[model samples]
Target: MFEFLLNEEQRKLRDEVRELVAWVPRQLILDMDQDKVTFPKEFLAEAGRRNLMGCRYPRKWGGRGLDWVSTCMVMEEVGVLGYIFACVFGVGAELVCDAIIQHGNDEQKERYVKPLLAGEIFAAECLTEPRGGSDFFGTTSVAEDQGDHFLLNGQKRFIVGAEGADYFLVYARTDPDPKADPRQALTCFIVNRGPGVEVAYLYGLMGCRGGGAGRLVFKDVKVPKANVVGSVGGAYKVFNTMMIPERLGTAAMTIGAAQPAVDVATGYSTRRKAFGQPINQFQGVSFQVAQAVTLLDASRAMIYATARAVDAGEDQNHTRRLISQTKKFVTESCQQAAHHAMQVMGGIGYTNVFPVERIVRDLRLASIWTGTNEVMSMIVAHEWYRAYHQAKTSAPRDFEADALEAESGEKIYE
Candidate 1:
């Protein structure tokens, strides 16, 4: 029944994307990382030609105007190939394209969104600062009003695609009113990384090396007032709205990466001999594979359900909680799945010669980035509390009547 949700059209899209990624040549991914390559502009151009760059955006802006399911399918396929490609497209589609489609002005949309969709330019988000990543409300980035423009000054670390990004959706504090809520104090701006902005590469990360995550410094960068995204002091709303798709997209990627690891490990177990028999014949190995599949499938279902909710625009709070839970589950499952894949393959799995080793390293970062699993747990718990309280308050009340009947020694029946 769940499989039925994917129609013929969706299935075709998935298969086509899978084939495209399959021909990417594994050595290319390795070579990109080895050389510290800039964002693969040519590869992105090919993706644009395929219409994969704007899978969920409206067709008016050079997009295909497909549903969220199609977007998830495309992400899953890219993720299976490698996290580098997945991260690039994720930032492009979710953070960049979605923002422009939802909030950018007519001029802003034409200049940024159109080119982004056409793969002529790449975009990045500048939210996480050195001191205020998990606690975004405590950001120190300040923007001073200069009449017709604003002066942005601060540093952002761990900015993905910084080296090649044509523009950035940067968050800065515009209101310094001590009484103002932190959420209301900040503003979002579309800043071109030139003049006063400096991008420095962060070398030697654990994985996802192909996608450049760097430190971005802003020294009184002049941003036009017109560059503001949405309304001034409305960044918190934008951030909250964006999280749903971001987390759901991440979950899709986790499923994609994990599934391949499971398949690789299972195939190896069946073919490799141990004690004069197939390793897969051993109950221990088989059980591990079973556990991996079970977790992966469960995570996939959770992710899909969350994505469906987002598409329908129903129960946003519930969707956010589910997205957080799904991201944590899927990312942790993928990491474990990658570990199992390597364990089953023994020495061969650890060598650079094998893809699993690289995948395992890449998956390790998933648990760290995209609001670390620890943060996801906190978000889920907080939402659960809020939901519980809302339910308690809205629940039908017959407490007085029930108490009186019980006190009078009368039976209370449902």
Candidate 2:
């Protein structure tokens, strides 16, 4: 909607989501923000009913069998509701559903993926832990191999849908040897809510509440061997594959969440007056609106290109770089755009009467989650260097030789 010219199918999907978002009760959003609700199950159930949950998967699996771009289009429209709605809305389809669709056995898919996309069940991905999510390989949560089953014993914190998820796609260290390679030492398991699984505590968050973010304690939870999504001690592949949609979907949804703030500020300025003229006449307000729109436009381009790249099956490394870059750039840009909206609205924007303040609080988490923007930068730089060196083997001009100092032999090195 920002700038991507959609085909008839894409436009139709967008309209459908717009109607769905319009249908969401405003009180539900407020209640969730105020910590009055644990999970927004109603929203997901409705989206699933419309067959809009995971548009990219096969229709046989309850998806539209659409491409990634179409899915992003859906996310962008859903995002306008707010961050909490956007985050929880995507957990099932983007993160949990994708993993099973890609790696789970046919039985697992039929049992989990079908019901999940059908909105018959809620799902959450347990990646972050008590120690921290950033140090993913530094997982303390262990699942001991117990012949017929694995005994999962540990805790996962900040898990959305912890209170209401029908099951969790948990990543736990499966290898007993401490010296095992971290990448190969882990595994993914679909742990259902039962027995020793407990939602120990629900955190009172600064924002983005009501999706049931909480601490999940698993005490000797017995999981059948068949529940393992991928190979034994092979969660790295699954995690990487899931992140493509994880980051891309978040980036797209955020566009809708952030755009409204800018639009609200723009509309307010047209009527808001300072010194007998509309606030839009002043550079202070108009410039902020101008800047926010520009940033939004820039973000749209990056998200659209990256989504297309993913759909077209471009190079893996290149696509990953684009994903990380889009995730980092779009989030940061949207955050700033919301800030501009707040600044433009001045005092009233700070209060809850206008949605700008809520937008600001909600948008703050976008840059932090889905892997921090800092992590995105690290991945981008790492990939760029690797790609640059790999492509350098082809015959090409050495621009360094053109520098006048090339023959001076004055270049010093450590």
The Cα local distance difference test for each model comes to 0.81, 0.91
Model 1 lDDT at residue 231: 84
Model 1 clash pairs? none
For candidate 2, what is the lDDT? 0.91
Winner by TM-score: 2
Instruction: Summing lDDT over every window of 10 consecutive residues in candidate 2, give the lowest-scoring window.
Output: 1-10
Which residue runs does candidate 2 get wrong by more than 4 Å?
A: 2-4, 403-406
Q: What is the lDDT, from 0 to 100, of the residue 5 in candidate 2?
A: 63
- Maximum-lDDT candidate: 2
Which consecutive 10 residues in model 1 have the weakest lDDT in total? Answer: 398-407
Q: How many clashing pairs per prediction, in order?
A: 0, 0
